[model samples]
Target: MEQSESIRELTQSIEKGTISLPEFQRDFVWDITKTYDLFDSIIRGIFIGAIIYGKPSFEIAVREVDDRPRKGQGKNRKLKIDKFTREEIANKVKVNNYRIVLDGQQRATSLFRAFKGIDEVWFIAKNESDYDYNEILDKNLSEQTLEEIIYEISGNEDKERISIKLSDVYDIMQQNWRESKIEKEIFKKQTYNGDDDEGYDYNLEKYLTICDKLQDIFKESKLLNYYLLDMDVDKFALFFERSNSKGVSLKFTDILAAKLYAGNFNLRDKVDEFKDNNTAFANNFNQEIIVRTLAYIIGDGREKIDKSYILKKLNHEHFTEYWDKICTWYKETLNFLFDNSYIVSQSWMPYENMIIPLIIFRWELGRDFSQMNEKHSEFIQYWYWSSIFSQRYTGSSNEMIIKDANYLRKVAKGERILEKAYFNRLARLQINTKDDFYDYNRKASALYKGILNLVNFQSKGLVSWENNNKLNFNDNRLEDHHIFPKNYIKKRFKDDLEAQDKMSSAINRTLIPKISNILISDKAPSKYLKEIELKNSSLRESLNKHLIPLEIMEMDELFFEILDERATKLFDIIQNILVDKQAYILQNHYKEREHQKGYIEIFATYQNQEIQAHLDLETEKVIYKNEHYSPSGAASKVKEEVSGKATSTSGWHFWKYKDEEDEVKLIKELKE
Candidate 1:
């Protein structure tokens, strides 16, 4: 095992095609930001982990490192040989002792590109100010701290900083880092004009010191550490799986790809082929979620749909048998979502993993959504809405998938699954108040996406802003544009972060045609509305379609009023869709228990004031200040009243009640 290999040696090896990736290794996917961080760590002499290399007992196919292609893009576009076959390798090249990268392919490829100046060149920017440079150096090199010392030049004029390409540094390091030579090379054709010779010399020395450090780090630092092993392809596959299980950043799909490759099935090529054939579906859903859905379908709710299960149970043969059927089911699932107006595209999906359960649910119900009965359809909608509003599939939702799949199967047979507290509890815990809508911004939030879906549904299908034609969900023409323009908000709010957040809320965004977005660029809502009204006679109707108040155009600078009106409207839409028989049953169930258990007194303290509230056992709500709120809601209400800002609170954790023994316990404790 070689524990010490200089950066120059390894990069040179990569340049000479002596060190290459094996055919089964995943392509490099690291972005420029990661490349910058890697070099930063190298310059700081930090241990950036070791790469593992294996010497095959026999000749193996290998490929040269190439620039990583974009998602769904063809790889090895520049290289002549995508993969040299074992026969071709034996015939073409006489080398058999080269090592294949088992781990750290991303890091190796990034280094190779930076040193060879392929695709994007790497540079280090340091402030020329002596005091600032000293301060930057003295501080501990955290990411934030490094931002002041190192940065990429963006072709902007900056008199206070000097930048040098990494390739140039590599050249200087190769010459054994002579100071006079490095200074002449780095600072050529530039002379100090300052009268202060001492200060100029100090800055010059500092710049020269940085150059020397770069050379020493790259030329002399033994950072390219690796473990050398001799193994066959089968043993290497096992090693890959074992290494990933012990916490490598390799994707499960990567491991699966390696295993499938052993069986003469190329998962990457197959996925790319699928994407090529189905462009629209591919655009909507990512490769990972699609593969995961296939895994879940293969598992069929009996096994966990994870990496281990997929690797062990889903071999190349199983995947081959089910490939066509799974692909068909996924296409059908997309159609179901579109037909139901749940989402027009994958962007509006609350969670990609949510699709896995839906796929299983629909497959179990006979793979045809049209044949689904009204009751079953209604239950599915209930489950869907509850999952979105409650943010059910946020993290580690494999268990939820199995549970939901089993429950949906029973629901298909007219079984009562909603009677269980688990089903109804989702509705109670999430989207309980209008505040939820008010707090939502246009981030990658499930609540935010759910709100947009609600708007689309209420609009009876949104139309293009340019032509009043109904939107076709099949393509990329539909865009979520801000009603209150982001440019207008920036100018209006300036540095007011709270105002910015309010202006950028999902309530301020709506689905519009791409052309309409360009037409309404940066204009105030009032200005655009008036312009739109002048051209279109059905302006009021259009506003109503988007759930926006007609009177909003008349109001001057009343952004808060617009937000409130739109939030209230969206909240009503949510309530109408999600409040069903199950919610009523839960309400009544609580009411039935209230008589037997009376009201539980709950209280808490905030800002030196004792807040008194009582739990309404019947409705499972907290009575505070003569109004009912969810436990968390009451806590937020009290904080808002005193602090003058909305806050998210875990109601169960906030309120406390005395048990029968008179010992005080949290509301969460009681529920548990």
Candidate 2:
């Protein structure tokens, strides 16, 4: 029962250092991203404080007991007990040790920030709550208040948040009462159930009081120097780990790397400076890989390394030698192939199309390549997402791609003949006309043919190609717009067999414009074709010219039919690109026993090293191209899919209606 006035008086003295915040108190308890957490507790009237002396330097906490006889009023910092139930206080009624909050880690940290200098400490109004999607999509949010947004989504709109006065927080903790105040015993809380060391589990209410006290001290005292000596490495690790509630946890290994060179010196900070680099942790590679590399680079066995290890390791002497190599690998190994588009947004590898495995090259092949090698950019991008083909790929197709990655690596390392084994079809390309897929694949028999074609074509450049006497697109920027919307198709159709069959077919999807996707305005092309033909004369005429096969103009079905023809032409354009892609990989076939895994098929080339040892290793990749038919014969379908979802009757099990004895009739009843 600390009185507001008494607590203010004591807090004023505490700010003067005449009194001190006790130790072993709980932390400020609130839920804000960070700054908001500090703000909300004060506004809602919760108690927060800090402690100095258990482990490390200190611990942030809410005070459980103090110097008071019964509990009428308190005098230290401003205090409030509106939410503290008798049960909660009773629980912490026993333990006693030193009793003064020395550091309000979270609060002090928060208030020192410019944003927290608020009307008092920060405080979100008690009215805030959940979000309603239906409301957000249709309602005018511009005119709504935070409370209103919450109300729209939350049935319990009237629920209030914790609140308290700023002055009373730090003030009420420093009182000189005649009798000792017994606080309820607080237990070590659990944040995550995975492991004891996993997450932060602290009381929120106690933290704000500490923030208030620290804020006052910062204002009253002109102490430019911060002495977080008690806030040593362990506490630093603990405090930082506990803080992140909404986002992801900062890996201990990363922290270990960070700790290697503690101080103002930044380890990961340099990553921010690079162009097109997402973070210090990843280049074109995703964040997880970078972290894994960091773990391995430190030689900390991957699992043992963390921020602490990093902090301990970083220094002027060793930081450069060890970290420089990683940075080099990051910029080169990672950058060479990380096509942002190919990276399917996964934790491992930038694009799970499998370019991530290339990092292993830095160790196996060494760093002879630079990120700026324009000649190799296409090679790298293809390799990064090469797995897209690999996952669905098999046979010579896969072997071809492996040879491709090997070829690139060898070529970079000054190896010749690496391109010889890479067979690419180049016969289709005519100096005067557009070459189709089969014509191109014909040139793909040898790596040299395709390489020559690629070198010739690329060296000619698009400007040169357009200038030549061949049909060319005037537009430099070609966008891959989906013909069938992935999201829209998913939403409108059930995941049943028919819907899935339609959705999965490549013929159903195609690319469109960045500004204007033709798929827009709802009613699909079939429904809207007639309107389009009447609206755009140029489109109608273009459709007539590129009729693909025979009677396109004859059908007169209109826009969709015309659009379908153009889309087929577009697919041809895409097919040509794939042909070049195939040639690129074909010419660069290094095909070491190591990359044999990528090849769907390989020859059994014996080891040149040992005669008795029949073979050095398996000289071929075990993969193959699998041909499949969609439910409707458009896309490939697995045997199971063809038999199960597509078949009219159960293909897996047969029913014998003509059993003379009906032998299984009794068994059927038992089975059921």
Q: Kindly give the number of clashing pairs for every candidate.
A: 2, 112
Q: Return the clash pairs for model 1, or none.
A: 631-651, 632-651
TM-score of each: 0.57, 0.35
Top-scoring candidate (TM-score) = 1
Q: Can you tell me which runs of candidate 2 are displaced by over 4 Å?
A: 1-243, 246-264, 275-319, 322-482, 485-500, 504-507, 510-513, 517-519, 523-672
Candidate lDDT values, in order:
0.68, 0.33
lDDT for residue 551 in candidate 2, whole number 0-100: 39
Candidate 2 residue-wise lDDT at 611? 9
* lDDT of each residue in 94-198, candidate 1, tens digit only: 464467788888888888777665534444455444445346455533322333555553322234455555666677765665767766665553343122433
lDDT of 2 by residue, 1-672 (tens): 111222233334334333232222233332235544533333333444422222232222232222222224443444321122223323333221122233443444344222212223322222222444444445443444333322121111122332233333333334321111211111122121122322222223222333344345334332221222234445555654674542435444344333332322344454444324545333333443444345444442222234444444434345545444655665555334322322211222212313323543454356444532544555554543333322222233323323333444444554533222123222222221221211222122322122222322322321111112211222323232233344545555545454444432323322112324234444444334444455554444332222232333244324234434544553454345554566555555333222222211111111222101011123311111233221122111222243344334221121111112222111111112
TM-score of 1: 0.57
Candidate 2: worst-modelled 10 consecutive residues by lDDT: 608-617
